[model samples]
Target: MMNDESLICEETANFTLGNTFYRSQSKITRDLGVLAAKIYKSEQGRLRVLDAMTGCGVRSIRYYLESDADFIWSNDSNPENKAVIEYNLGFILQKNKGKITYKNANNIFFECFNNKDYYDFVDVDAFGSPNPYLSTVLWATKINGLIYVTCTDGRTGTGHLPENCLQNYGSYGRSHPAAQEQVLRLIIGSSLQEAATMGLGIEPIFAYFSGSTYRVMLRLLPKINLSLDNYGFLGYCHHCGEYTTISYKQLGKVNCYHQQENKYYNYTISGAMWLGNLHNKEYLKTMKNLAISLKWSTVSDLLSIMIHESNFPPYFYTLGEIGRRGKLDIPKRSQLIEALENDGFQATNTHINSQAIKTNASLKQCIEISEKLINNSKVGKIND
Candidate 1:
């Protein structure tokens, strides 16, 4: 029989996982979190972390060792994993550098709020919906602190369960080409709504989708920033493969602008979600610099894409969609981006999908651009 404990090494930390759920693929997420924590520590001159779902305590260990966190509160609701967590985090426990607790995440937040004890970094790597912690987490987060939230329930966020979407995020989710991005916005917008209720605000440092998981890192602000310009609906036209934003006042006029008076078109609207930039450009640049200094090439590359697409429209069009609508073979993502930029349009590859491009150019413009690129082989394929 295989032993319960297995040695695992990630980045600068070495730990043992014992029957606790550990996803090797999620290492990139952990890397980003650690980098953010390290940056916070450097700026604030101290790092205090509250990891709500410690699992095997890998996050807590990384915060302490890699981020140079001065103190950590690692809590998990399941007591079965206590021994494994303690074993992996024995040094910190013995040194009184942190504490290990078995408590519900909400209870911990409540306790912190009651005691006015807030953390500089609060990470709730929840398995499913983050609704339960969306509001409560703010209670334990210091003003200007960072809150990293996770949502693993893709179905609900992607409109598979529209009913559940309304209940969970206070927004309507509709399945579309940009559903992954939709979910990320939902998480941010929902958190903003919760924060705004308490006269607070938040700015997204980054929103990442790892194929199946959605994670957003937000910086809690001390003032209110809920506005129509930054929170609204996303409208997608099924017929034209186009996207547009709709404000509350535009609800009654929600129709595909591409539709002719006599033509019928299908439109899918998803929101009351975040309509602002998916990432902070300067912050991402800072993270990219740190990643480069640390010799983390993959992270640097990902951040490059994110920085480019940070201020793009809320949705993206896949190469396949462009090709199918234009009745042409799929064009290379890189070439399409080049074509758009040559035409004075903002275009870049989205980190959400490898074959997708997020740009301010309309879908028709993209199709025409793609067609021109395919025909003008001398100009188009060269960029390839």
Candidate 2:
């Protein structure tokens, strides 16, 4: 295969682009960067962005070609790939001279923040957990600046290894479909908690999970009343298969099955996290509009799902899982959503899982609807 292609980076048959072009899910990152730049330019004009871990500069190249960013700094530890980065950005570097710079990622944040240098955006897309870079970015990010971080360590994020999850994220993580959103919360909570220690506050504007990895983009702002209110624990009831998100203040009053006593009632608590909205509806609206203009392949579809679920709370319940627990036939996701809506419960589709649905309906109401839907399905199927 050829060494260079158009804007797209194609892998060679020999798999030579090992450490460099690894993030195959580049489109999501690119689309987000483009949308961010588009929105930033409209709101505050051009922006300066930093790709803290630029692997072969694929993301940086996209930023230059697809975004309205004024300057892009692609930094990485491997200086040997300087030529590769230069070649990738050749198209934009020619006309927009001095617009893109490549350098080592070594002590980059310290140098910038020490000199009071800040960027409109800073991305920490490291291979493993992005926790290590949080301290630095919190200081380097300008007020209202955006910071995008990705954690591919699904083992820890998903609670497969509780010890590592606790070590890196400082929270107990529970493994479940409904609690999958907690993995994203665990990551966001860590970033927010880390920022809080430094007298700064982090506001998560966008977050999504794909292929066992979680990508989140947040805004850095000053700490005024930014307490642990944004950070709290989540309670998952094993008996009813329902989870509740509660703040730290409510910890004293938290009980797994106090509302209803059942033989199978059991509860597990999961963290001091941001139980609030994982996404921002207003910003998501802006992203949808901006994404429409950009014409990405699957972004509009993804954004539509996120927009619908943006207004709802964090946890989601799966109809199939709930059906199995109720010992009833599974109801269609669409049917469940419609049933909830008809019952005056605001139901929405969750992008986290296709079989899952998010709604403002209480667990009891949701359980009631599931039984009703299954009963209706059984009658229809029996008649058929």
| Top TM-score model | 1
- Per-residue C-alpha lDDT of model 1 across residues 1-384, encoded as one tens digit per residue: 223356788876677877898988998899899989999999999989999999988999999998999999999999989888888888898989999999999999999999999999999999999899999999999999999999999999898999999999999999999899999999999999999999999999999999788889999999999899999999888778888999988886767654456665656889899999999998889889999999999999999999999999999999999999999988789999999999999999999999999999999999999999888875656779
Worst ten-residue run, lDDT, model 2? 10-19
Off by over 4 Å in 1: 1-5, 259-266, 378-384
lDDT of 2 by residue, 316-355 (tens): 8887777777777777889888999999989988888888
Off by over 4 Å in 2: 1-19, 91-106, 258-266, 381-384
Give lDDT per model, in order.
0.92, 0.74
Q: Please give the distance, in angstroms, between residue 210's alpha carbon in candidate 2 and its true position after superposition.
A: 0.7
Per-residue lDDT for 101 in model 2? 42
Give the clashing pairs for model 1. none
